[model samples]
Target: MSFRSAVMAEKEESTVEMEETNTNSRAEDEELADGKEDGLEQEEVECANLEEGGGDGDEDEDDDDDDEDQIDNESKKKTDQDKGKKCVPGIVYLGHIPPRLRPKNLRIMLGAYGEIGRIFLQPEDHSVTRKKRKAGNNGKNFIEGWVEFRDKRVAKRVAASLHNTPMTNRKRSQFISDLWSLKYLHRFQWCHLSERLAYEQTVYHQRMRTEISQAKRETNFYLASVEKSQTLDRLRKKKQKKGEAVQDKSWDFTQRRTEDEMRLEKMKKKGLSKKNLQKAQEKSKAIQEKAQSNVSLLAKIFSSGRSKD
Candidate 1:
């Protein structure tokens, strides 16, 4: 009985030791799960703080950029205002403008760049004679002009940009094919154009004088031609009269006549001879008078025309 009781007690002690080790293992597992949950909460808090700080920094950078842009715009405006206050009047000349290009269109074009002041264009010539036109003597038809701008700097800029460049129109259908053929006169001044125009006027008057003198010279030659043709007609008529006289003489010789008839014939011939001499003298006087009148008429016409000119 004693030996059995001792064996039973040893078995009870071994079971108690196993239960204590299991309880200790359960406590360690609970502690590890609690630590993991606390670590997750701390990480979420740090992430939220970092996001708030990043948003503030981004807003600050955007504001700085906008401030810089505004400053630049203000500086540009100031410079443009200064340029307007100090600019002077300026002029430019064009050498070869197209016949169809009008002043209004040019004004509209140039006004886009700057303000305009004055414009001048060469007038078209309308003095071509019908004979020359019929003989296909068509001359060159081009125009030249000058334009004054409101500001000298603007004028210089426009001249530099448009010089040696072809002009094109996009909005108007009529000018679609009419590219402007113009040459900007970079070296000429407005005063030079005025001087050249005055010179041209004087030259034009001199040309008119030369034309008047030439017309006077041709007048006498034209009259001489008319007189020469008139003389030829007179000679022809005289030859016909002589031939008729010869025919009459032949008839007179063939016919027989008495002495009384012959004496009567002689008397008639003397009377006809005196009449012919008088007619000849009158005709010569009339020719002299006509010649003298023509000279006076030509002189009067030329002198009157020159005086009017």
Candidate 2:
């Protein structure tokens, strides 16, 4: 009976050990499944973040495109404004305006035809101011002026009909002769005039500078000047000889035939048809004779009447 009881106890111990091992394995499997599920959820969250970032990047690109478009539009508008400012149409230039004519009076005369926009009168020359002042002149003689019209059509009409027409101003109710000398400036702009004036001034200054430099040049020695003068004389003689040779070659009057001479020769060779001309002359002579006879008869009748009176 004792042996049977010990074997039963061993079997019971083995069964309990197997049950603990099985429970530990089940707990480990459950933990591993929970970790896998957490990893999957993290991956899904990362994918969602990547999608949202991609959308933001696309939105940024669209905003950049819109900014570029706005910039382009603004640049175009600026270019248009610049073009409009540079090319001003319907502007006319009136030159040689009478200095006595004030801007107000000029507008009054021109305004009869059209609306005036701007007027520019040439300024009095400062270099001549002193001379003019000494001559008892207030520098109000005649000034060159320009007039701008508002409408191009009105400017054209006025320029056509009013060019070279005389202008007159009243003085104490006496009728003064008008000397209207108006000219239409074609394709002439104020800027062009300013440019020309600037160029002329530059040229004048350069000429003055050159003249001063030339005057300041060292004088040549007497012997050297004599030699130079002799050389110049020789050159002049050579030029004269060359000119004479050229003249001799160009105009050999002995052989040259003028158009009139050539035509006379041609007519002599061709024998002109003078029959029609002779007929015309005879008819004219007959008419003259008839007129003279009529006049003489009228004169005789007048004489007879005078004698009777």
Candidate 3:
């Protein structure tokens, strides 16, 4: 009976010890699960923060693109405004352009004064050009010119200062001794000059056409007169060859009475009165009767003789 009681106490002690060990192992497993859950939550928070930062960078790039577009639009507007602006130009007339002075040289010389816009140099006359070319002088010459200036005030000032002055100070220059004859023309535009040139060209062409027509008409008339003269000559030669008497019919116009004879006749009429005129008529009648008696006696004698024979 003592041995069985001792065995029961040992079994009870061993079972209590096993129950405490199982409780400790369960507590350790719960701690491990909590630690793993905390690590997962930290990783998720970091990923969300990185996504928000990336979204902010994309928004900053969009803002930069919008700013660049606005800048471009403003610049385009400024360029358009500049293009819409207009400027009024002025003109200067040159009375005489010297020899060997070309438009290029003129521009180079005058560009020092102000901004030059348009330049026109009238060429020398064609006849003069031909003569010079024949003489072995082939250099181009300008008769007159017109220059455009950006500003009216500058044009006026240049014209005033340069008139009657030497063209240049350089002694070796070809135009050193030449004088400037400049005049500022008010209210003159380039269009007016163009119109004038066009009109002159049209007039020149019209005159040329008229001259050619007149020359052709004169030539035709001359040819016709020559042909008529030749035909008359040929007819005269044929008549002579055929032994025909070519009677030339000439018309003689009566001569007009002289003023002196008319005056003398008028004087005689005025001097004779009505009485003298009747006396003259009676004497003329007596003379006519005597002449008729004589003629009748002669006819009687001639008839008697013929009868006796």
Candidate 4:
């Protein structure tokens, strides 16, 4: 073969090798770039996943806070209701207790035993009333009040535990051992407003006003007429000691009023005659007994008639 042909062959082979190397280098560069791009893509995906996971955790935390707040509110309301002790159905209506039994220390002592609803220290309004009442026996003071509990069982336990206790602090402390088991109250009822007794109070006031007015007028007239009348003549002469001889004819002017006269005047002013009061009381009692007997007889007749029918 010619030398030129050989040289051309060698140059062509070298050119071919250079071209292949260039192509292989380009392929390697593309593969490396692809690998880097794949790594970057993976990192970005991981970042996105991390952000999503963190957001989910934050949402869960928020939900947990809401649940906790709701529970707290519910518990607070329930606790308040129990503490307030709002009386409703199934509450007790214990009868009026006497004021002297535990006037000052009943509540203080009873409260320590259990959660009492209220210690109503007023009289019950269970009687018929009028518009205006007189201050008399009909004026009831609800000296008794009831205690309420959240649970009926608790109420029973408290009630059963409060009776016959030493309810005083003056050398006497009431022991509440017996009052913890009281039960059987359907519901509690309290009296709020009662009408005043009209008729009895009217009569009492009218009579008093008339007597006072008449007495005042009579008193003024009596006081004024003393100077005009010969009061000296009517006045009883007082004797100087029985054994002494009287020499002076001049009478003592300082004889304002005898003890007897003053006592008579006081009696009249006060309208105080025991005989008169006794007679009046007897008449009233007689009338009451007669009316009661008549009522009893009528009731018997009605009952008999109804039974026959």
Runs of candidate 1 exceeding 4 Å displacement: 1-88, 127-142, 164-173, 176-187, 228-309
In order of lDDT, best first, we have: 3, 1, 2, 4
lDDT of 4 by residue, 2-78 (tens): 99999999999999999999999999999999999999999999999988799888889999999999999999999
Worst 10 contiguous positions by lDDT, candidate 3: 259-268
- Top lDDT hit: 3
Residue-level lDDT of model 3, residues 202-241, one tens digit each, is 9999999999999999999999999999998888899999
Error at 216, model 1, angstroms: 3.4
Model 4 alpha-carbon miss at residue 190, Å? 3.9
Q: TM-score of model 4 relative to the true fold?
A: 0.27
Model 2 residue runs over 4 Å out of place are 1-88, 91-95, 123-130, 168-176, 216-309
- Backbone clashes in each candidate structure, one number apiece? 0, 3, 0, 26
TM-score for predicted model 2 compared with the true structure: 0.36
TM-score of each: 0.40, 0.36, 0.55, 0.27
lDDT of 1 by residue, 175-277 (tens): 5544443444555567787899999999999999999999998998899999998997787788797784322224334667965557556757777676765
Q: What would you estimate as the lDDT of candidate 4?
A: 0.62
Candidate 1 achieves a global lDDT of 0.77
Task: Judge candidate 2 against the unseen true structure and give its global Cα lDDT, from 0 to 1.
Answer: 0.74
Clashing pairs in 2: 166-180, 167-179, 167-180
